[model samples]
Target: MTHLDDTESDDIGTLLGADGPFARELPNFAPRLAQQAMARAVQQAIAGRDTLIAEAGTGTGKTFAYLVPALLSGERVIISTGTKTLQDQLYFRDLPKVRSVLGARLKTALLKGRANYLCLYRLDQTVREGATFERTQAAQLATIRAWSARTRRGDRMELAEVPEESPLWPRVTSTPENCLGVECPFFEDCHVVKARREALEADVVVVNHHLLFADLALKQEGFGEILPGAAAFILDEAHQIPELAGQFFSQSISARQLTDMAKDVLTECTGITGAIGLLLEPVEALQDALRKLRLALEPLPTRGAFQLLEDRADVRASLHELRELLATLEELLASQAERSRGFANLRERAELFTERLERIVESHGDQDVRWYETFPRGFALYATPLDLAVPMRGLRERTHAAWIHTSATLSVAGNFDHFARQLGLDDPRTLSLGSPFDYARQGLCYLPPDLPDPNARDYTEQVIESVLPVLHASNGRAFLLFTSHRALRRAAELLQDKVPWPLFVQGTAPRPRLLEEFRASGHGVLLGAASFWEGVDVVGEALSVVVIDKLPFAAPDDPVLMARLAALEQSGINPFMGWQVPSAVIALKQGAGRLIRDVHDRGVLVLCDPRLTSKGYGRLFLASLPPMPRTRALADVQVFFANALSPDARDGGEGRAGV
Candidate 1:
């Protein structure tokens, strides 16, 4: 119901112009045509209540592009990002700067999922059972209790003393199934309730994709309809939506859910007489069944269709036993449901798990794929729909709000059809704004010649050999992104004592710590896998080269991917060209984007996959990237780096071929 006046519409362009408020207030701000154009398009989309698909390349200042229009729109806005880290960045860093520069009067709030908040009721329960925890965990619990008395927001991120992966987190946090809602003794002062209440009243709310999709999928995360009634929904890093939508729509059951239910039942028994004797046998039986099933699945592939269970008689037997034991636990809990609210919740969880297991086991429809994935000591089963377009479109229509999807890599070969079809949009408003950064002058694309095929047995070794020269030329300030962990590990082993610069390897430390140390190590070579492909920003001379080991195609053995490809083929679509290629192209765009983050950033991108040259589809990948000059010879790369670091080069002199 909010509309922009003529002056306000003009102000979007003027405010983001060279003499805008940002240019005056911020020291590093520079105006770009692409950013202004994107702002106008977003403004129009919000005013007209239309869907807009925007692809703003890196350095386009897409965040500001959307934020300016959103803040100026004079309506309730919800901005959902790709990750929690980004959600924090927007809420803590970006929003404040823009709000200050514009002097906007809108109220804003940061809302995360229930797991991010501390559950006071659950914390009290854990305190009562402190004797059962290890010495370190008990100490961690004491720390959390002390912090709980003084922390205002109660966000777990506020407590850096406790590591994120600490087991104590689950003991203190409440999931939707365990939360008693208004029935809890601490409902009046609950943090999740307070956060949601603030979001309901704020003019703008910042959330991650998981919370946004959880609302759309109607998944119970303690609160209800936290995102509804917003006039605009701006999805940043929108390229991650299609795949994430599938995850939200899927019906899943996991070993952790079952184990947690058993643990909760035992915790509940502490308050009720005779409850322990009644539930002890069934709880132990269910735990044993879960362990047996995991052991049975250990012999199969880590992930595959549910049909894999049919071929293994032992696995089938174990699954059947697990299901039966779950039913017994549910029935026993039902008898004690009348005793307490906690018992009633436990009964419902047991019943839900039993029904989910039955549905997953019985699912044989062609429209959905029933798949199972195994971890080191756990497993999860899912029945995921083949297409998310119908449900996603339905959700959008129901919202009756403007939808703006923007990211750096939403298009393939200058086309948006692949991304649009995934989201079920039909010729929606489209805008493609290239990055204002001078890619041609600031970067070089080096496809190393004489490299073996990516599928060859010695491909990893060859890739390490090929990138060593590039590393030497750049002084090893590089990120070597691989398609899989096996290759990353191999590269790390090969580069260990062979290079003069320090090496940073994934899995050795937390992602944030690794990035921090890598940035400090001026000449460090970091080896990483999928997680490093996107949402990573490293600007300046610290990161000068990015070497991709292979084309980032989804593994063919993935159960959901295999099913989706088959469905596409049945619909007369070229699964390889239409689905796989476009997906890989978007992924490659993200990988290549790391090389040039700022206007002054100059680096070489080395793609070690020979398939990019040997195959016809290579053209699509090449055309989608930034317009960096391409080279096939190693000498060009050497010269590009040598001249790039020279003082003369810094003073506008050039020795590189493309330059």
Candidate 2:
């Protein structure tokens, strides 16, 4: 095997294109110009050590496009993905395949957020306390205990019997907040520390956006920094970076935080045997304060930003009481600093949490927005940045490396201005690689006319009515995607008795299982929210009709979005054009890209929102889509699917006969 020199890097075409090793190494490899082009661009970025943002359309083999270049560059690189699912795929499948193809001796490590790993300290504490559990959870914990005795990685994903959303997970895992760090008796055997050690020393590391932010924000637990040492960075699914970075930069404190801290202090006192008796009094007082705060805010609406919640007499009083109690707790914990190291760490965390809550409640940052997210159990107060550019600019300056942000949906109307501006990257070398799918021959963009505006009260019902016929034509191999829970529930209610196929909703099961069941059901109609729009791939005839209830827009009432929009308005910016439209366009592109996933696949994309046709901004959404044949008539959509469901599509024969 020969090491490719700088001159040989130009042969990226031969490597990715047909008649190259890809053809011989991969049985089903179909070369696309977009993939080859993107790979070369990535190679160039690494060679020059400059920032680049590339949008490779679907079927571009983007994982290889970036992975191949990064691996070949022989640089200490970190590739971050949007989700853990993709993270695993890159580590376990794509990276290995590409490395094998390159004959590269790459040292790779996969690191997830700390929450994914089991904390032996937490697990032992729970087990020793004889914590009560439901029968199923008890059995699950028993299985975990049995596995814990032998497992090396200690990743919760190894427990295939336990679902990812199981309530038992949080009990076993450690969050950054509750983590005892080096104070734990099991510190030497900690899995998170082990994983981070591997990532810190490896040639290539695969991480998720959350972990990347931890590195970029310099808040990672368990070890040394990961960002400054890496020679290059590649972010797959880069569209998720802005929102994820926003979360990391923001500060939040919640009733749950207080409860967790109190519980941890008490558990420490109880679990550590004859140590730290003085901490319990303040811990108990802290618990009482938390309860008082919860009771005070119980009467108010479940959620609102500080603007709405701060003025209420009961909430204000509760805030004052909680702040005073937290202060007292901090002082007490500080006094115990000399007695126990754990107490010292607790005091520092308490101080941080207290400071964070004050900042959130007071709206401390100049460009920050104060908001709240409500829940049935409790609510959280947040101080979120209105824009991530300032913080992102700081990260860019701190790290001198080639930063590549690549995704299939990073651009709107063939432009990267929205994404670049959000991330404070001015004049990055940008490229847009078109999809290889012949959308003109394989797909149809169905826009039904005379539908009500998406905001109207009758919108969900109208959408259901409009798509019922399309479902019939395709024999119910459809994905019904909604933008809101209210809309999803309404559509599910109306279509319950009408649709012939089995109906599947998002929350009914784990995401992977739902997709699996939907696929196995063959004609199942799965209705879901934003999660359903992206990261879903259903090839062949199982998914032939994609029905979008409305133009994909973030909720206007959402705390973060609302605050950002207001901030933009204050700055004399057109919030709608500058922020809202581009966001919606990117989301709509994700929803639309769900169809026609494979070369031979065929489907009809149903846009149920009338605003998509009536409003002027709709043109931007259309321009972002793969240029498929458009139709305004319902009969045309029905006919398109009718012809698609024929033997033509399955036989790999000519399609687009009806359209």
Candidate 3:
């Protein structure tokens, strides 16, 4: 691999400058100083084989900042994004544009987890059991079958006709436990295999954090890793890495996995004579035990530590029965393993589940928190690690590649220590670049006066009442971002008839469709919870007001959080300030970032919680926000919007107030 020398690193600025090839070749291209600085930092990191934690503010064009260096570095690069949507965008849109503008001839491949690709073996199994499906599902299966023939990539993203939540997907897709790998008849033509093969030979591979961490955790041992050895690794939206690392490292077993295994066993029995008669009763008994366990857990809270199960006699009995049933099913499947490949896979799955259940139930180690969360019709058990730093650092050291972590909200109160600690980076090189959007001129932060505590029973109602004037001032082009779904629903109900704009609530429609209609409505008020806080972009005047119901904090009742806080306390750390506050600050930043996406974008941010001024620690949250002018009076908000809409407003006529 060729490294960028000092002279070549210096040229990165000129390459991304106003007179560069990008400006000449790409339309609407504007050179940004912050982006240039970030590109230089990334180039230096890559050339020196160092770890860099970069916090690029919104509008910094962080994608291009890292891309130009990665493309020019002449090294195999792996770019991991926070979501599959961003992964696709980076591969299909951003990478192509940057490569074309730079004239860099390099190969790039898009690789997702096996769940995203269609499995020929599973498709055949589903086809054999077509009559067992409902009419709607059967039709959906037919559509997928038709698509499977012509779709070269077999990526589910290419087929938007079928809803992502359709039950038909799991039937046609393969999981790690069920995949036959090289033993399958369709091994030569397997979509996941073909994609991984292409990725191995490509100069760059685009993947999401789940797949990246899955690889680091060695969760794909059946098929091996898809990410190739790289000279440099760039993780976009790096703030998500800490939490995602914990999830990937955790041991988990879901009721859905057990049910799926049972279904697969039934499907496998279809081809072998007398197999159904022998295995059907064990599968049914396992499913009945699972249902009983879920029912026994209904009286407790939705989520808590494993100790909760020990206190309830009925729950304990149900769990014991479930474990016994799983063991029995494993024994039965072992008898049928020699029948076929499908039976062999089923037996392995049953054994894995049995072992996982026993481990989770028996684990009492302080390093890992054993917990369970019950869903509407299912439940999942997890034994998550108390800290991710050691394992994450281990992975980094094993790679022996330069690591670049960049995100819009990585630092809190201008400090990257919290993020660095989470990923176990000790005294790492860091860069913090402010956005060039001129937030003081383009945006105003409005902290509504005299709101009750966030925990008040009628707090949601008061929040709506406080923001009603701001919503009216902005003419209903706003996003009501809540920390919890309960508040979001309450606010939605309160404003249903009060405001005249088209109300787009989160649960009413798919997120993409809601965003599409919201953008087109011109005066839509969209209300959403956690998922809407980040990864949402609405530029221009279409979204002018962003109302946050409360300071974005993790719920104290969360099982994992409780365990982590306890662990931190034992280590002589103030968990509230050291952990909770910093985490909330990053989350609040992500929510506030939804405003002023572009330089010309103008908006008012209404913070409904009085804690910003009432609490001593609130300063940390306020300090982390962009340098927007702050205001307390609703009249200033009204005037700002009024002036923003006036014909002469382009020259900074909006009102400004100090924090």
- Report model 1's TM-score to 2 decimal places: 0.97
The Cα error of candidate 2 at residue 266, in Å, is 1.6
1-659, model 3: which lDDT tens digit per residue? 33566777669999999889988889988899999999999988887889999999998999999999999989998999999999999999999999998889999999898899999988997786656777888789889989999999999999998999898898788889999877899999999999988888899888888998888776563434545368888999999999999989899999999998998888789869999999899889888988999999899899998899888999989989999889988988899899899889889999988899999988877789888999999999999988888888888888888999999999999999999998899778999999988888888999988888888998998888888888888889999999999888888889988999999999998999999999999899999999999999998777989989899889877899998888889899999999999999999999999998987788998888888889999999999999999988888887787665454453354533321
Comparing 2 with 3 on TM-score, the higher-scoring candidate is 3
Compose the digit string of candidate 1's lDDT tens values, residues 1-659. 34467776677889899988988889889998889889988998999888999999999999999998899889999999999999999999999999999899999999999999999999998887766777888789989999999999999999988999999899789998888888899999999999999998999999999999887786677445667788999999999999999999999999999999999999899979999999999999999999999999987899999899988999999999998999999999999999998999888898888998999998888878999999998999999988989899999998899999999999998899999999899778889999888888899999998988787999999888888889888888999999999999988888897998989999999999999999998788999999999988998788989999988999988999998899889999999999999999999999999888887789999998888889999989999999989999999988887776565554464433335
Point out where model 1 deviates above 4 Å: 1-9, 646-659
lDDT of each: 0.90, 0.83, 0.89
TM-score of 3: 0.96
Which has the higher lDDT value, candidate number 1 or candidate number 2? 1
Candidate 2: lDDT of 641? 63
lDDT of 1 at 623: 92
Residue 356 C-alpha lDDT in model 1: 88
lDDT of 2 by residue, 59-129 (tens): 88899899888888888999999888888888998888898888999889999888899889878877888
- Candidate 2 Cα misplacement greater than 4 A, ranges: 1-9, 222-224, 271-281, 299-302, 338-341, 363-365, 645-659
Regions of candidate 3 where Cα sits further than 4 Å from its true position: 1-6, 221-223, 646-659
User: Model 1 scores what on Cα lDDT?
Assistant: 0.90
Best by lDDT: 1
